[model samples]
Every structure is written in structure tokens, then in C-alpha cells.
Target: SGAAPRVDPRLLAEGIEASRRAAGAQASRLSPTAAPRQVPNEPVHQDGLRGLVERYWDNPLQLERVLIGQVQPGPLSPTEQAQLGRLLVEKHLSADRGRTLSRIGDEQRNYPNLARALGRSFQAGALTDGHLGYLLGPQGLGTSSRRGFEYTGIATLVAASGSPALQSTTATRSWELGAKQTERHAAVDFHTAAMRATGGSTEATQVLLQQAGPALIAAVDAVADLSRRAPVHPYTNRFSTALGTLLTGLSHLPSSQATNPVGARIVGHLSEQHLTAPALRKGFFDYLRSARTSRSWRGLGPASGNAFTQQELLTRFKDPAIRNHIVTEQYYRMSQALEELLPGQASWATFAVWASRQAGSAIRGEPLAGASGTNANGVRAISHGNTLGASEIAPLFGAFAQTLRSNPDASFQEVWRAAGAPNKPLLREAFQNYFEAYQLRRSGGGADAIAERVLVANTLVAQHEQTALQADIDSAMRVQGVSMWSLELDIPGRVLDLNEDLTGQFPPELRYLRNPRARQLEQQFGGWGDSRMESLFNLFRLNQRDAALHGDWVV
Candidate 1:
């Protein structure tokens, strides 16, 4: 024999404990007092290693504290720390698999300590590409019955580690794995893999883009081709969704710097060939329109049989819920990409036109209470329009304004240039009108004007139903609740009696002549005074106050 084989005592001890753990038995027969105490808020030590590894593998916070030296454990060798780090990464990958990778990546971004620890272990020989691949892979979270892939986590890790080998391996494995999946799933995988490839160091990201960019574009094209081949298939719907996701990812990639030549080239290709393509735009809208019709109204039972088409279902049932959801999601994604890439006239015009249509639909559907009962047609129309306006239009306009504010340095000329220099005056005018409208809406005056209109409408309604309105007001006044300053302020008995009497009138109005001393007292000590009473007094005194002030009521 060349030499007598020997095993270290520490290795033997560790192996025995590991075996005991594997067999679901106690690692040692040490007495309770002799056993190490695992105190709370203490640094993990070698004594706590087993429990730490077993219990804290999935607990990112605790694991992070230990790795970052926040928790003072008794003692751990470098090797032991590395082992723990490796174990944590492995467990996280296992726990995180099949879930949306982007979400997992977002979570990882928040836990830099964990990433640092994993990176350290990776630098050492403790973790390999296989371990990283699993951690950074497109494997998603789900049971054998249902599985899903996520790429965000992998992207985050690749970015954090800045490892060329890991990036390359993740890219290759993602493509291979996705190729075996359905077209929609594969598209998702490819998109996420592309995102991950574009992460990491400048050199690494460049290398990945050069290697993986063409493949990603080709994959996207293939999905589009498949959609064309089977336009009516349900899979085409999924493909459309995937394409939206893919375009979103591509549009959001980091802008190129001097060091990122490959990224610039890749972005240029995507921008020219895919993002700005008329075909892609048409595809997105067409898919969304088709999706509206494809929804199944299974809940309607027999009634659904007659409404086989989406339009037929809508016409029969007058339900806009499905349409609203589908349209909002699809249009929101498209608008987001447009704002990011185009960012001016074209994007604003698209949103404005869509919003106008939505508003028109809503106005046409405005409900009217009828003599027979509730007008179902009016109710349905109003409900549909309101849903679209509230969910989609408002958010789109808000986002447009926010995008402009956030990119103040991006001038009209720049935006026009970026948008391929479309009709300048038309764009300039659109920008001006949009900003003016946005400013007006943001000012409190718009809300006040709407409130005034509503008040007038309510007054007209009350005029027609005087008796009913009086009775409602009388009932409400009787149930008057205590105010925030109930203990400090008390209403005079005569004032309460007067208010009760006023409530019985069709349009109750009360006014108090200006008493400087009383007014001063009210202003100084009436923090929780009755708002309705104040409003009534103000309304009655409005003309007098305006005449005295030489304008509208001052306060």
C-alpha cells in the first residue's frame, strides 16, 4: 500500500452526526445540561450548526444575519460557514423552483447579504455550476401535478455573482429546458433567459448578448410563426400573452454604455426588428381582441349556450367584466413598453384615443332610474364603461404624466426624434394639451368643479322629491353622532331645536349673521364643529360674503 488511509476524527464525528440526522435519530446522547443552548439573538456557533442548517436553511433573514456576522455564533470555521452558505442556496433554489423567476429575483435583490454569502461560497470550491444552475435555473415552484418556471431569481443571481460561467450555463440550460416545453412556456423561458443573459458584468453581459441575442430573437419569431399557423388555437392565446411578456422584458433591458457594445447591438436589433414593428403592434392588439371573445362563461350554464361568441355573450349578458380585465392587462403592458421606448406623441395619442373610446362608451351607458324599475340595459352599459375608465384610462393617463415628469431632460425634440420624428406640430400640440389637462386635473379646482356639478344635480333631484328628501334629512339629523371634540364643545339646546326644525324643510338652509366675537370664538375653538351646519350657513351667506370680499367667498 502506498500509504495507510486515515480519516480525521472531526470528519468521523461530522459524518456520524449527519448519518444520525439522515436516519431521523438524535445525533448524540449528551445530557440536556451538557447540550449547547441555542439562545435567541445570539450568533450561531459550531454547536448550533446542525439546527442552523436544518431549521434556518429556508429562513433567509436568520441565515443572512449569521452570514453577515450580525448574529454572533460561538464559533464556525471557514469551511463550516461555506457549507452553511451552500446549503442555504440549495434550499432556496428548491423552495423557489417553478414560481415566477422574476418575482423570486425581486426577492433576492432585497437580500444582498444572502447573495453575497452565496457568491462567496461560489468563489470557494463548495458550490459548483450544477448548484448554481439549480438556483439560477428556470425551474419553477409547483407540485408534480402542476409545475411552473421563473427566471427572475436566476437573473438576480447572475447579476449578483457576475460570473461568466454561471451566465453561460444558465443561458444554455434555459434554452435547452425551454425547447422541451410548450411554445408559450418556452417563450417565457427564453424571455427570462435573455433577461438573465443581459445581467452580470459588462464583459459577461456583452458576451452573453453576442451569444444568446440572435437565438432569443429567433425563438420569439418562431413563437410568432406558430401563432400565425394556428391563429384560432387556445395555445395562440398563451403565445400572445408570452409575446407581451417577452416584449416587455426586451423593452426594459438596461441601456447600453460604452462598455456594453453587445447590449447596444442587441437592443438596436430588438428595437428595429421587433419593438417598433407594425406586425408586433397589430399582433398584440389582435390577440387582445381575440382573447375578449375566447373567454368561457361557464357560470351562466344553459344561458351561455346561446352566447357562444364573446360579442354574443356580451350582447346577451351585457357583462363587461371579462373584457375589462383582458383589455386592461394587454393595453397596460403595451402602453408601458411604448412609454419606455417611444415616450411622447405616439404613446400619448394611443392612450388618448383609447381613453376617448372608453369615456364615450361610459357616457352612452350612463344609467337612468326608470319608472318600471332599475334600467338593466343602462346599468350594464354604465357599469361596463365605469369599469374600463376606472381600471384602465385613469391609470394610463397618470402613468403618462409620471413618465414625462420623471424624464424632464427628455425634450420634445428628443422625444420626437426617438419616436422617429413624427409630425412635429401635431406632436407638440398633443404634448401641450396633455400637460395642460394633466395640470388642470391635478389642481384641486377640477375636483371642486365636479363637486359643484354633483351638488347641483342633487339639488335638482331633491326639488323633484321634496317630501322624501325632507323625511330622509329629518331621520339623519335625529341620528346625529358625537364629534371628535364632544367633551370640549357642546351645542346650545336652542340651536339643536332649530336644526331639527330646519331638517323638515325641503331644502333646509340656515344662516347666522356675522358676529365678529362669535366668529372669532368659532374659528379658534371649533376644530370639530358640525361640517354640515357650517356648509349650510356658508351657502346662505355666500352672496353677502362675496360682495363684501369683492370676489367669491374667501374661505
Candidate 2:
């Protein structure tokens, strides 16, 4: 405290009166209106997009104007169109941007267009599915009188009606729009046109069968042409009958084998389509179940009478043609699963050990138990591996392989290409391998049930594959140090693909669920509700409470 005080002694006030008088004199000379200079906010360099973005990002109206201007510039090229989407997003979203932004703009400037266009195509001259008009038709009147169909909404509707590729997508889109504000009569008209045009696709046909609402009138006549093709639609008196319209449609679609329930073999690259029988079955049955119990069809009036007896439903379900689809679909799933259970490029040698075990199990007639307690169905459950060798089965498999030599997949196909052909023992056993694959959690394949399930599904196996089969057998048998091989596809199927297909079709709301590859819902959700959100979710699944009361197949 004393240190500064020493220098601050009042003795240093050399000019107390002099400074006060001098400062007062100086202040008297200065003006009271003096102000500091100001500078404008102009960038040192020329402003481009980045500068503009940095300048006015805080202002919403100005940003919108910039965005509108960007969209202008006399229509962007297809390549530019794609880059602009990400570029615009980046300019607006300031937070998630940095080096990546610059790289996207610079590195990918010339990349192909990735953003798909979602609308009618001028190149294809495509229209909406069925040009749906309002169903303002009066009750108890001819449908035509009540239907408010019109081609007058837009110049495109009339033009589109004539030049179009019949697809159900637009109609489906309109149905999905359901009263959304942006969708207008144009959407309805487009849907009608699209619906009217589709005769080649099952998707379109199913859309027609299930279609309702204002646009349905427009599709009604188009669907009328399909009346003789699908009998259970528009006027089926029962819920099951109406639902079976899909089967009828499948039966009539061009190139569909009349004997098989499935149409066109769902040939595509979707992994989900190839595997997960349970998920597929669950999805199928769940859809049927929802439709069966729906109080109203498409939210129209009350659903058609469910007056059909349980036995009647069962009878329809058990129809050979219907069951054929069920069985074949199961087999398809089984083949896919078995193929997956095999190996990828991995040599057959890798699978021989497991194959031997399965062969032993098959030979002894003692089914091995799996995680599902007493799961003895073996390959039928996709739980156990398919065995390739045994005293009784090897000879027959060789014979079966002989038949499949010419098939490219070498995988079993579900169609019955040869009718009235003499049955080979291999046909029976091979079919038995997949027959019970679709049964509810396989319902525990009893000896008698197993015997009954060995129904025939002969298509791919034939004389040509004999050499390939023998070669494959020799390759794996060499690995086992004895005779053994996998009775699976030479190629491995992708399980991810199966799960993908199973979940891909889910509504947007369900897209987030953990993709479970269960062959049965019980396998996936069986032990849920004990903890996690399950207990809370149980409240919403009250409908499933009665699951135990019905037969597993029915459930």
C-alpha cells in the first residue's frame, strides 16, 4: 500500500491552478458537435454463392429469394439438377457443413444424376394408374350415374389417357394421397389413367381388387374387363372371398401356370424376396388377418359379410391351387434358406462336416432338436443343415441331380414342369425336405405329419445335373473323409436380402423396426413384453391376445 503512495505524494501536483486554468482554456476552444467516423460492410473480394450465403443466411426472405433464383437460370441440366439438391441443402443447413461441403461441390460436380424423378414421364408417355373421378355417385344408382369422372381437369389428362404405359403406381400414389392438400383432381385423373392401363402387372391387378374411393369408379370399367379374370372382386359377398381376389388375379395373369398359386416367380434382385419364409408368411397372413377383421373395406361401408364359415375359409385356404402357392412359396423360402445354409465361394468341403451330421440324423430317423425345443423338421425349419449323403438318400439325390443338370440355378424351382410323369423316390424325399417349411413354427413335424407333407414339387431336378451332382458329391465327400455333401444350392443365398425384402415393403412408419429374420412371428416377438417397451406395447396388441385360442395355422 505504501509503494505507490511514495510516488503519489501530492508534492507532484506541480500545476494544480495552472493545469485547471490551461485545460479550461483548451476546452472552451473545442466544438460540442464532434462525431466518430463510420465504415460500410462491403467484402474485400467479389461475392459469389458462398459469400452471398454467408451474407444473408440470417435473413429468411432474402435466402428464399436466392433459392428461387437458383432454381431459375433457365432449367438446370440433369447432372446439375442432382448437384443442386445437395448444394442447396448445404447452403441452407449451415450447421452440418464443412470440408465435406466443398468436396461435394467440387469432386462430385460431374457425377451422374442420382435424385430420381417422381412423376409422369414424358418419354414413356405414362399416365396415372386409373384416372379416378370422385365417387359422388348416388347410393342405389348405376355406378356410372354417380361416378364424377372427368377428363376436363387438365390438358394433360386427355393426352395422357391415350398415350400411356398402364401402371398402378400413380393410382397407388393417389390412394396414398388420400386427402392430402397438394393432391388435386389431376392426381385423381392420373391415377385413373394409370389404373386403366395396367393389365400386365399383378401389383396393378391387386390394386384394382382392393381399390375403393372416388377414383375407383374410373378404374371400375377397366377392372370390369378383368371381371371374368378375377371373380372375387367388387361384389364378393364374403371377406375371405374378396381377399382371395389376389389368388384369382394371380391365376389369370398372362404366363401364370394355371396349376401354380404364384405368378411369374417374383424374379428380381431383392434379397428379402429370397429368404425368411416366416417373415413372408407372417406378412401374408397378417395382411389377410387385417383384411378379414377390417370393419370396413377401404373405409367404405362395413366390410362384406364374414358370413363364410370357418370351415369355408379353411376350404378356400386349403384349395390345392391356393395351397400350391403356400407350399411353393415355402419351398422357395426353403431353397433360399438351404442355399444360404450352404456356403458361398467356400468349397463344398467346408460344409461336409455339418452335412455328415445331418446325413446321420436322416439315416437314423432321429430328428435333431434345435433352439425351438424339439425342432425335428431339419432343413424344413431352416434350422438344421441339409445333408447330402446317406445309404437311402444318396442314391436318390444323385438321381434327382441328374434331372437338374440343365438348370442354371441348379436350385430347386417350385413349378411342376412335368405332369403325369412317373414318380421317382427322389421326388418324394426331396419334396419332403421342403414340404413342412411353411407350417406354423413348423408345428412340430410329427412322424405322420412329416409323412403327409412329403408332397411333390418337382421342377429343377433332372438328368442333366447328375454329373454336376456327382462332382459336387465327390468334392465334399473328399473333405469328410467319407461320403457326405450339402443338399443345398451350389450358390449361397443372401439372408440379408431376405430380411431386406421382408422389411422393405413395410409402411414408412414400420421401416425403423429391427429387421428380424424369423420364420415365425413367435420366433421374433414370442418373448417380447417381459421387459423393454414390450409391456407398454402389449396394450396395443390386444388383438393378438386371442392368438392362443385359434389353431397356430389360423393365427
Candidate 3:
């Protein structure tokens, strides 16, 4: 081998010492030295590593070359060797596969395959292995989509596309991936320089819109180019195709267009570029007209049912009112503002006012008497730590209320039973409370009296519900061969009619029921003359006829 270049060991020591001294001095100034606290052990920051690489290599493409030049592949020192194994394993199989990709190249301090393998093996052996093993072992190798996408593509599509937000969010994630490759702060500086050129508020918006429109159009075009180049990346191609359609649509809108003033005299004034001027003219007028005439501002704004999601449009503006009035309120608020744009209308001024009333009846939800279904006692009891315990009573109340609304003649017993009948003790306890309230109303007057009267009405309603329930039961039993009595009952109406001697007297209108022949006719098929109904009718109807035909002492 050629004679190695001679190096002064003392000079190398001095250079290292110099850096140590500098770092120590800076650390002393920046941080107060305190007792060491236990912290998670992590590798040196990638940022620091990258900075060192950039300082030495200067070119990103020359990472491997620079790394190879700086460090020879050999066994690492004790401490370095301990961490080397971990580094290898991390690079090959981190949960986020891209982390390894990010760390590769000149910045990584290129080592030979043997050295890399040793480091990785050490990491695989020394680490806790729980999470790491999950990534590398057979346990995680399954083909389930939740596992490893073992299922068919059709299943994945159905699962993924069910939620609309998830789709948009996934597409928007391209911004994050693209941001990693560029210096964003540098781009902002460029934007700032352009903003300073445009001297007015309106001019700034116009310029921004103009630039964004074309940039977006170009981005969409680039995506189309990518789709053609890489046909296999279907997901990316789909997203790109959608974005292209959106960008194209936005480019044609009025807001994207720019304008310059007719006559310019000022040295630094911005160009006249108010995109909203025309739309605002009609919108403002409509808003003002509706506010003056309409009792409710019902049709003043855009309908809520429109297909477009409003989040993107809202985010584009700073002021909430600008979003609400311009983008959301249709042409109502904007038209009036435009009508005043002329010379004489320049004197016009409008201001929003905020005020409140003492008794704000205008707000819809204020509790009104008889409107709130809950009673005063129920409300009071609710405040006290009392559980409503109205499960039994509520159904009963519902049945009664339903019947009262539909049928006035329904009895209370039927409704009560259907409501899940509570025992007599419970009813007695309820009545006690009712009677106490009734006495209180007798002592107190006005609304109290009326409320007491409602208590009585409630009892009657509940009683009617009970009666209807009994009639329903009787009618059902009669059909099922459980009841012997011959009485025709109307379940809903809570009315009962006599069909025979055992069922008491028939009413004048029901006298037609007295004829046994007529009863047979009434019971069967269409009329009442069916065989089954006639058999039932004979039991009731024949008795009435026999009593009518027989004379005293066989005269």
C-alpha cells in the first residue's frame, strides 16, 4: 500500500477540543445546568444529521458519495455499535415505511452491507420487540384489509367510499406529501413580494385569485400527465381526475377574473379589481327589500339544501359576515350594496344593529301554558333529585290523551289496562296527591283553579281509556269463545248494545236488532245472515221473538 498521508495527532486533538469547548460554552449560556432528569433515550435528531450533511455535501444528490468519502465501513465503537443494529432494523421495517426512505442517501452516512446488517441484527435482538415484532412477524402478515388487505377490491371500495368526508380528506392528504419535498417558507417570501406590489385590498384579492387560478389549473394538468405516465396508481389517478374537474370549474367563475381601473392618476394606488361588485349590487338590494317587508327573513338567504359543501368557500374568506352575506345569503344582501355604487348613492350608509328585549317572546322556544306537555308538578319534581317514576303513568296518560283527541266517548278502563295497569295502592296514592292539589286550588284561585279543573279532566280521560280497553277485551273474547254474554261492543267508541234478553234493553234505533229473523240477516255474509253469525244471532234473537209471541195464560 502507498504510504498513508501523515496526520499530526496533536492537531486533530486540538480541532476536536476546540469544537467541544465551543459547544460547552454555548450550552452554558443557553441552559441552566440542573440535576439530570430521566428522559426517553432516542437517537440524535435527523434534523441535526441532515444539517451536518448539507454543510459538508452541499448537493442532495451527492449524499451517498459524501457519506462514503467521510466515513469508512467498519465496526462501530461500543456505543455506536449498540445503536447501529436498531438503525438497520428501523430503516428496513419502521411502521411508517417512508421514514426509512427519508433517511436514505448522503445524509445517512453510507456504510457497507456487512456493517448495516450487523446494526440491524443488533436492533432486532436488543429492542423491546413488542411493537417491532408486530410489524415484522407472521402475526401481521394476514391478508385482511384491516390486517393486510387479503379481501377483494370490491369489499375495500364499499368500505372506503361509504363516508364522503373520508374520501375528501384522503385526497387532500396529497398536500402533506408534496410539502415534504419543498421549502414552504421560501415560497411565502415570494408571495409577500407580490402582495407589496398590489397596494390595495381589492387589488390583492384579484392578484391572489389570478395566480391561484392558473396555479391550480397547472396542478390539475400535471396530475393528468401523471395519470398517463403511471396507469397502475389508480387511487392517485382518481384523485387527480377529480381535482382537475374542480379546478377547471373554478377557473370559469366570475371571481377568478381580474380588472384594471379606466383612469389612473395616483403613483402607488392599486388597480380596481372588485370581483364581488356586480353580484353585490343585486344581493344587497334583495336583502334590504326583504328585511323591510317580510315578517320572517325566510327567502332572503340561499336555500340550505344545495348540493355543494360550504366549508371550502367559508375558509376562503376571513370575515364570517362576508361568508354569510356574500356566499351564503344569495343575492339578497349584495344587490342593495351595488345599487348604491353610483355617484349620488355614494352618500348611502348601512350599519348592523344588535339589541335585546326584556321579554323576548320573539324567540320560539319559550314555554307557553298548555303548550308544554309537561305539567308544573312534573317540572318541580324533576329539579329535586327525583326520578320521574312515570313509566307506569305515562303510557296510561298517552292512551287517555290519544282517545280524547280522537274519540270523546271512549271509557277510561280500557286505556288504563293497555297502559300497563298499576295496582290499586298506586292508584290510591296518585288520587291522594290529586285530592291534595284540588284542595289547594279551592283555597287559591284563578289559574290554580283552572289547573285543578284539568286534574279532574285528566281523571275522566284516564277512566274513559280504561272503559275502551275492557270493551276491546270483551269483543276479542267473544270472537275466541271465552265470553258467553251476547252484547255488541264498540271498542274505540266505548259503547255497548244489547243483542238479547241477557244484554238488557236495546235502544229505539237498535230495535231492529230485536227481530230474530232480522238478526240472522244482519249476522250472515254481507248482511247479518251468515251461518256462524246466525247461530250467535239465534241465541239472542230467538229469545226476544219467543217473549214477544207468547201471550199470558196461553190466551
Candidate 4:
């Protein structure tokens, strides 16, 4: 009898989300237009849940009535799910996970209806991680029992050795535009099942992950290639988000739960083949970093879930390999961007130019904001091109360059970690702190206060603190160019997108300054920094400054 995981899988099952009807259930459901039924006198808060658990200590049957009945009818926020999990743990509600083995036995011996429905749901991609995790646990998808063999449809769908598997003849016709959609759904189902079952039972998810690895890798290559080759595919919009989820799930799987072979096949293959490539990596990461996508806190997954949260799915770059790749790819793009400006065929000059651009951008916002190769003599506020300016981009990326230069031999991952995991240095903040420290230099000054908050910097972010500081300073340094400072500093490489449009495929909001509306509006307001801009600028600056000076600013 295996002990349960730190978080109860039952809570994950029922508590994950309440509004979503479990897909593929044999039980009849209300019509789509029907109003949801609420459980009478259902627990509405944490205290209410705790009291119910305590009162029903020995009465699991009665206790589950409301939990299932209530959740089956409505939705639970991630907060509620977390609270339920904590209560279960605190109240010692967990039992031997093997306790589910008997249910599998009962189902296989007497009634296979429920079993078949769950199996069909899994095969059809109707279940997600939380649903599958719960099914593999207390809901009884089987532990190590022979009854588990009946769920081979789920495994077979994963092997994708059958039709509609994307590589197969039936799934490849040009008219069958939904081919990519089918493959992605199935892959999501199997990968999620592997993560869930691994958390619950060793034998099940291991077999799942091990079996799914080769097919998944193949599918990854195929779908990514097909999406690129035929961007007009009906499901083209979902390719990046779906692919991101797969890589993220694999990365989040701890080696302790998954076999080393599984990790090597999936993680290693993904990192080398997909992530190492520029366009593929960009598309995947764009999905992760994107805020304007269809994925949101309400429904969670890019592929609608049976029951889950965005926090639960985390298709957003959960893998460290991806993170490491992002660092490597950043420099790679930087090198490429710097190449056109490099002197004709100098062996070592590219790196030097890249370094200089880093310096030039950091100190004075350089190359004067032009397209990929042109260097004009004007404002360097991150134009649509090769120049690396700090004006429009965040200051944190500059810090990554600063960190990388100081530690020449460190791995990108190590360098980012040392610089601070998820933060880019706020240059103006750094400048202000450095100056403040200089004032107190005799006393060996300390910026004890603003040292640990990433939120404050985003405040520099939305407030356009760095933008204003750069524009004001660069307004003067256009002639002589401001000299670089903070040469030895390092910040989070994950902070900014290097102000480069890594993928030309993202939504307009993600495109930011590169969009047409901004330009048109600016033009209408009287060209650069005209009537329409001052009021907005003054609004952010004055309000933000007021909040900052009064110590009322917060994330």
C-alpha cells in the first residue's frame, strides 16, 4: 500500500475545478443551456470545509455527497482547490493509495461501465492531469492490478500506431486540416496521464511515459514541422500553445517519479532538436511569455480542460531545459543581430560588436534605433531592428548581458541564476541605488529596502521609469554617447524579450511598440512626443512618483 502524495489526489480530482463537467462520463448530463445546480448548503469557505471534514471524520460516504455533488455542479477557483488539499492533509484524510486497487477489482468483476467511460475519456483526450491523477488514485484507474490492462486503449492512442495519429496515412491528407488538432489533443491526454499516474502509482505512469516518449518525440517533430510548412492548417493557432504544454509537463516531472530513460528521450531530445532552433524556440517561448493568448485563469489550458487551472496546467515553460535554452538562444539572436554591423569577416569581431552593442545600449541606447542593420543618428528606443537599445526594452536584459560578460565561462543557466532567477536589473533603479550608496559610501551603504522585489521593477516597467530616464538622457547623449556603467552587474535573463520580435506571430499587444495603432495615434497627436503623448507621460510619472515618494506603491 503506497502512501498518498503530499497533496491528496481526490482533492485534485473534485476540488481542481467544480464547474467543468467530467467529460465522457457514462452518467447523463444537463443540456448545454441548462443552468448549473448548486449543492444545497454546500461549504462556501475554508472554515466551512474544515468543519465538514472534522464532523465527518468517520463518515466518508456522507462527506463526499456534497463535495462531489457541489463540485460536479459548479467551478472551484485554484484557491479553493488548494484549501481543500491542505485540509485533507491537515485532517489526515489520506490512506494507502493501494486502497484504490479493490475498486478496480470490483469494477472489472461486476460493473465495467464506469471503467469503460473513464478509459474512453482518457483515450479521447477528454481528461487532463488533475482528472487523470484523481482517476489513477482514489477514483480507481487501478494501481498494479491486471485490471489495468483493460485501459490499453489509452496506451494505444499514445503509441499512436493507429490511424489519425498524424503520421499515419489517415491523418495526413491536406484536406484533413484537423489532423494537427487530433494529434495534439491525444498527446496532451497521454502526457497528462503520465504526469498524474506517476504521481499516484509507479507502474502505471512509468509505462505510460516510457511508451509515450518515442511517439511524442516523433509527434513533436511532425507537428512543429507541419505547422511551419503549412501555417494555414486549421489548427495552426494552437500549435505553439499545445507544444509548449508538452515540453512543460515533461520538464516538471521529477527524475524520482519518471525513469532516467524517459527524461533523456523527451527532455534531451526536445532541448536539442526543438529548443536549439531559433524559430521553433521562439514560437514555444512566445506561448509561454504571451499574455494576450486564449489561455487564461478561468479555463486554464490551451486545450480546454475537464477540470484544471492555468496554475495547474502551467504549459508555460515549466522546464528548466527550456529556461537554459532561452538563455543560450538569447545570446545566439544577439550574435545574429550584431553580425550585419560587424566589420567584414573578422574572426573575433562579432563577439566584440555584440559586447559593444550591449555596452552601447546600456549606457546610451545605441545604434540609434533602426532596422536589423541600419544605424541612424536619432532616438535609440528599441526600433524594429538590429540595434540593442535600452530605451523601450526593460533594463533587466541589459543586466543579463552585464552578468554574462563578467562571468564569461558560466553556463547561461548558472549565469541567470547568479544574476537572480526571474528578474532583470532595473537600470535606473540600479543607478539610483548605486548613487544613494555612493552618498553613504563612507558608511558602507546598503539598499536593504528595494533589494528583493521584482514587482517594484515592473512598477518601473508600467510607470515607464526606465523609458523616461533613457529618453531624457539619450536626448542629450545623441552627440557624444553616454559611457557604459554597471559593467559588472547581472540580472535575470528572463526579464525582457531582448526587445527583439523573436516571433512575428504573436498578437498586437505582444507586438507593443511595433504596432500600427501606436504609430497612427502618435502621428495624429503631432509626430514624436507630441500633444497626445505629454499628458499620458505626465499622468504615469506624477502618479507613480507620488506613490513612490509616499511609499504607497505596490505590485
**Per-model lDDT:** 0.38, 0.27, 0.27, 0.31
Off by over 4 Å in 3: 1-95, 99-349, 352-555
Q: Of 1 and 2, which scores higher on TM-score?
A: 1
Backbone clash pairs in model 1 (N, Cα, C under 3 Å; residues 3+ apart or in different chains), count: 16
Among the numbered candidates, top lDDT falls to: 1
lDDT per residue for candidate 1 within 1-555, as digits (tens), equals 122234343453455345434545444532222423222222223334544655555556666655554544322334555556666555555554524333434466566766655555666656676764554334433222223224544545544554545555555555555656665754454554544443433344355445555565556555555444334433223333344433323333343322123222222222212322332334333333332123222211222133222233233323343344333444444344333433221232232223323323333443212112223343343345434333423333334444555674555444434434434343334343344333434454343332222223222222222232343333322332211111111111212221221232212111331334324433533233444333332222221111121111101
> Which candidate model has the greater lDDT, 1 or 2?
1
lDDT of 3 by residue, 376-479 (tens): 33222221101111222333333443443355444445444544556654353333333333344445633333233223332332333234334432432333
lDDT (Cα, tens digit) per residue for candidate 2, span 1-555: 011112221222222212323433222211123221111212211122233434443333433333333322222222222233333334433332222222222222132121121112221222122222211111111122211122111111212222222234433443454334243433343333333323223555556435543344333333223323333322221111212332233333332112121211110111221112232233233333332222111211112222322223223342222222232222222232333322111111222223333344333334332211222332222221122122222233323333333342333332223212225544454433433322311355333322212111111121112232455434333333222222321122211111011122322222222322111222333343332122212211221111221222221
Q: Which stretches of candidate 2 lie above 4 Å from their native place? A: 1-143, 146-316, 343-555
- Which ten residues in a row are the worst by lDDT in model 2? 134-143
Instruction: For residue 472, give model 4's deviation from the true position in Å.
Output: 15
